[model samples]
Target: MAAENQTQVTEFLLLSFHGQPFLFILFLLIYLATLLENSAILALVSLDPHLHSPMYFFLSHLSCLDLCYSSVTVPKILANSLRPQATISYSGCLAQMFFLMWCAGTECALLALMAYDRYAAICQPLRYAHLMRRGLCVAAAASCWLWGMLDSALHTLLASRLSFCGAARLQHIFCDVPPLLRAACSDTRPSRLALHAASLFVGLSPFLTVLASYLRILLAVLRMPTATSRRKAFSTCAAHLVVVALYFVTANLNYNRSSSGAWPVVDTLVSALYCVLTPMLNPLIYSLRNQEVRGALRKVVGAQGTLRLHS
Candidate 1:
């Protein structure tokens, strides 16, 4: 029943890292930190009534996204660390790629919306509440989710068509676009262009949008009469800016790779930033910087701390 052009791949051998034994313990620590941080963020965001604001709303979603995104790969990675070989089934690899792309793209759009929210808050302070009304914020978040679903669905469709004749090894820990394309036996021109175009649209376009928004925000901040007000505005956006900048820098370095001269280790290091380290620290950064978040976290902790004390 298999089409001659379409060879069914039963499984893929994942090359997470080659011959690096010591890295396992380091990666375990990083994975645990990422999981705990994301979990803490989600709990605080969901449980803390004080964090019921547009900014923390998006941060909650981002934390949840990071948790899901990392989960698609990390547990398997840790499991493989306990063993020798790390292999995943073909359908599972496809699913992993779809989920990973969906989460990353959604996070990209979410960051842009969060930046726009900050712009509205700081640059047009009076209009902040009216502009970022609960309905609109909910709509914006829904749109990001829909866009992510659409992107994942399209890539999955294209991936379904590709044939894998013989080679089964995937060069990365997860089933990424590049490694999957390389592993395919059939012509992968369509898949490559579609995925890369999605990357440029989803990845590069957001970069430009963030840049433009921040430039306008900068101009507005410069015009403010009080240095104190300007400083306060800057502080609010600072953590978000840091998170976005760190994310975009590593993400671009990873996805914008050229086939002409590929550097695996360099890409690995950069990918690690976005994949492992960024998610691990994002919630902590925001919680530390934002008083509202801090208050909410305290409330959550105080409530729990009280429960423990009473028990």
Candidate 2:
């Protein structure tokens, strides 16, 4: 019975914010800005030999993840904002959810890896080089991507099996797990449990690891002799902490919420913050707050200027 019902849902109607032209335009600008910002950071990291360390290696990957993360949903959002009604095929919806989950999971792992890198730099300065060697960094990054894809595949597979009802309208902007589970006529217990477990494995567990790393870092920073050293250490961790807090808080709130009621407005707003706002802000936070990134940007700009002058 459920399988028969599942076959009926050909496509899903995504909730649109197009009626508000001002909001649509604002989102369009944000989408473009996120892409450009992440792209610039990625290019700068790749081209500059000064940024060829473990820290910048992770930073480059972070930029790539942010770019890919926003790309998963933002283009659809921009399209939806311009049209009267927005719809996605069932397979397309599943694909979107899969990629989004992949990015989200990978980000969680990367953040934890970054925190560990910071911990080594601050507390184990003597062994920083040995601890975060090129081989280890590459392996860690590869693990993040590989594990994330596997996690996402699990969620997407479970989601694909669930039988969706005839009502093709999704209350939220995208085909997220929570809302999609709510649309299913089949027993969603297994899917919800899988989601919760995956969240813990990919989200909560990594967050806890990051928290522990920071706690250790804080202890080390306090023991430093000079105020300048302490401040520098704190500054290094601060931007990352802010990004982590924003991402986890919004994601946990939305994903862990009871799926009984369909709150389109609330869901849309929350999704916008994580899916839209976070990606836009990530490059800005890292570039503006971190002197190293700023210096690299300046060098890039200066080099461009010199090249144009010669030409």
How many pairs collide in each candidate, listed in order?
Answer: 0, 0
Q: What is candidate 1's lDDT per residue for 1-311, written digit by digit as tens?
A: 33563545678888665357677777778778888887877787788777788987888888888888778777777676566787888888888888877887898898788778878887788999999999999999989988988888888888888877765777777677777777777778888788678778888788778877888898888888999988987775666678788998777666656651265566557767787777777777765566776776678778889999999
Off by over 4 Å in 2: 259-262
lDDT of 2 by residue, 1-311 (tens): 88888888899988888788898788889988999999998898888898899988987898899899999998888788778888889999999999998988898899899889988998899999999999999999999999899999998999989887767677878778887887778888888888889778988999999999999998888898999998887876777788888988788877887753466788888888887889888888766567877898899899999999999
Candidate 2 TM-score over all chains jointly: 0.96
**Per-model RMSD to reference:** 2.5, 1.5
lDDT of 1: 0.78
Single out the weakest 10-residue window by summed lDDT for candidate 2.
257-266
Q: Model 2 Cα RMSD, Å?
A: 1.5
TM-score for all models, in order of appearance? 0.90, 0.96
Query: What is the C-alpha local distance difference test score of each model?
Result: 0.78, 0.86
